[model samples]
Target: MKRTIPLAIVLTMGITMMVQFFVPHPVSVGYYDLTTRWIRIVGAFALVLGTGSFIMFHSDKVRRRRQGWYYSIISLVALVVTTVIGLGWGIRPGSILQNVIYANFLVPLNASMFAILAFYMASAAYRAFRARTKEAALLLIAAFIVMLGMVPIGASIWGKLPELAEWVLSVPNMAAKRAIIFGVALGGIATSLKVILGIERGWLGGGKQ
Candidate 1:
């Protein structure tokens, strides 16, 4: 009964939303806006669920004294401290502690993480861009042109390199990006249809056998 009710709700909402997209009536627009608000309410509830799950997992690890439990403690402390600060004092820029913590600690930490990510990406790129295959060679060439086109040195070497690179990006790259987006949209529509029609019941839980 529980599963059936949720499935029916999903099917009805999904079909209505799809229909509203095609119908330009004021009534349809109102319904679409209503659905969007409902979505935000559901998202708030989901965030609470997610935070609870995160805390529970980390707490369990800390209690069990698992490997690297110190890190779990640090994570929990950070989460709690941040949440308290945001809630207690509205995160207005002029708020002293909030602004200080965010600007000095969080911003630097985020930037450092991104810097570390760049090194990892560089390592991965080295492996992936190696000209071991024809496809890899083409990728390497495209990457080289793109990187060179962004800088002044390439123009010094060949005045046309930048123009050629811009054309490559606008022409082939743009077309390929559009093709991928269309493919993804079609795949999403297919998957959503399957779910609404009850063919994708894996979301219901283990009793689906």
Candidate 2:
């Protein structure tokens, strides 16, 4: 009964949304506006659910004194502080709480994470660019040229290297990127259709129905 009710709702909403896309009538537009409002309300409820789950999960880790429990404590404290500030002060720019938590705490933390990620990317790039084969050698040369082309030293050595890099980026790189994006879009459409058709039931917390 529980599964059936949710599936019915999903099917109805999915079909309705699809039909509205083809219909340009005022009623269809009204449905679009109404659904957006419902989306916000549903999203608010989801945030409350997610926050509760996060707090409970971290609190349980802290209670059990698990490895890295100290980090869990920090997570909970940060969550509480951020939530309280957002609710109390409305998170307006230049607010004291926003400045302290977002500017002082989050900005530096995010920067440090990305800074570490840059090192990992460099290591991975070094591994990939190792000239083990013809393809790898070509990749290494292209990457080196591109890197050199971005700086003043390349201009001193070969002023045309930058133009070659620009051509490579605009042509081959963009072509590959567009192909990847097209494949990803097709995959997304497939998944969306499967969900709308109820072929994918994973989101309802179980395997396919």
Candidate 3:
């Protein structure tokens, strides 16, 4: 009975939403609009619930003095400080939260994180581009051409390198991208249908309905 009621509501709403997409009647459109508005209200409550859970989880860690508990304290402090600042000053342009916390702190932190990520990406690329096999050699050559073509040195070395790079990108790269997108779309549809039909009950929390 605990999960049954929620599952029933989900099934009804899912079918209604799917039907509304195909049937453009006034009633269907109005129901969709009303449901969306209700969704926003529900989302607000969910946010509050999530925040409570986050605080409780960190608070337990801090109380237990677990390994790396200091990081949890920092997380909690940051959350509270940001929440207070946002609520007190508002996050508008030129506000203290925007100019001080965001511009001065967050922007540089994000840039530094991305800089570190670039090194990791380069390391991965170096390993992947090793020309041990024929396929690996082909990939390495394509990657080399693409990278070099973006710079002035490639044009200086060979006049047609840029055009060759453009063809590789527009032809093979785009074809692969479209194939992946089609696969993803079909998978999404299958997953959605499973959820709508209640075949996917993992959302109910326990293993296998």
Candidate 4:
């Protein structure tokens, strides 16, 4: 009975949403709007649940004197500070304090995090590009060709290198990426339909235990 009720709710909401997209009739539109607003309220509750879980997990680690307690403390402080500042003084983009916090802290932190990816990429490339097989050798050659194409000096020496890079990037690379993206899109649509149909009931704790 519990499973049946939730399944009915999901099917009703989901089908109404899809039909609203295509039909746009008054009844369908009203039903869609009502369901969307209810979903937003549920979403707010979900956010509270997420934040409460974050606090509980970190607080538990702090209480246990975990290896990275200091980092957790830093995170908690940052969260509290941001919440208080935004709530107390508002978070308008042009506000002096908001601009200062973003320019001084957020921008540099984001840049540094992105820069760390360079080291990981270097380590992975070292492991990946060993000339152990014909395929690996071919990939190494392509990588060097692409790297050379990016630099003015190498491009000047080999006039066709830049053209080769352009072809690689525009043709095969884009085709492969598009194929993978289309597959992912189809998979996502299938999963979403399953969820709406209540076949994917693990999301609701296997239909209320």
Give TM per candidate.
0.90, 0.86, 0.90, 0.81
Which residue segments of model 3 deviate by more than 4 Å? Answer: 125-128, 207-209
lDDT of 1 by residue, 1-209 (tens): 77889899989998998899899999999999998998999888988878999999999999999999999999999998888887888877787456678888888999998889888888998676579899878988988998998799989989999998999899999999999999999999999999999899888888653
Q: List where candidate 1 sits over 4 angstroms from the true fold.
A: 124-128
Residue 176, candidate 4: Cα error in Å is 2.1
In model 1, what is the error at residue 114, expressed in angstroms?
A: 1.4
The model with the greater TM-score, 2 or 4, is: 2
Show the lowest summed lDDT stretch of 10 residues, model 2.
Answer: 122-131
Cα lDDT, model 3, residue 73? 95
> Candidate 2 lDDT, tens digit per residue, 148-207?
887888888998988988888899989989999999999999998888888998879955
What are the Cα lDDT values of the candidates? 0.89, 0.87, 0.91, 0.84
In Å, residue 119's CA in model 4 sits off its true spot by 2.4
Tens digits of lDDT, candidate 4, 49-71: 88899899888889999999989
Instruction: Tell how far residue 59 is off in model 3, in angstroms.
Output: 1.4
Off by over 4 Å in 4: 33-45, 93-97, 150-154, 206-208
Candidate 3 lDDT tens digits, 1-209: 78888889889999999889999999999999999999999988988878999999999999999899999999999999998999999978899899999999899998998889888988987676578899978888888899999789989999999999999999999999999999999999999889888899887897544
Could you tell me which 10 consecutive residues in candidate 3 have the lowest summed lDDT?
200-209
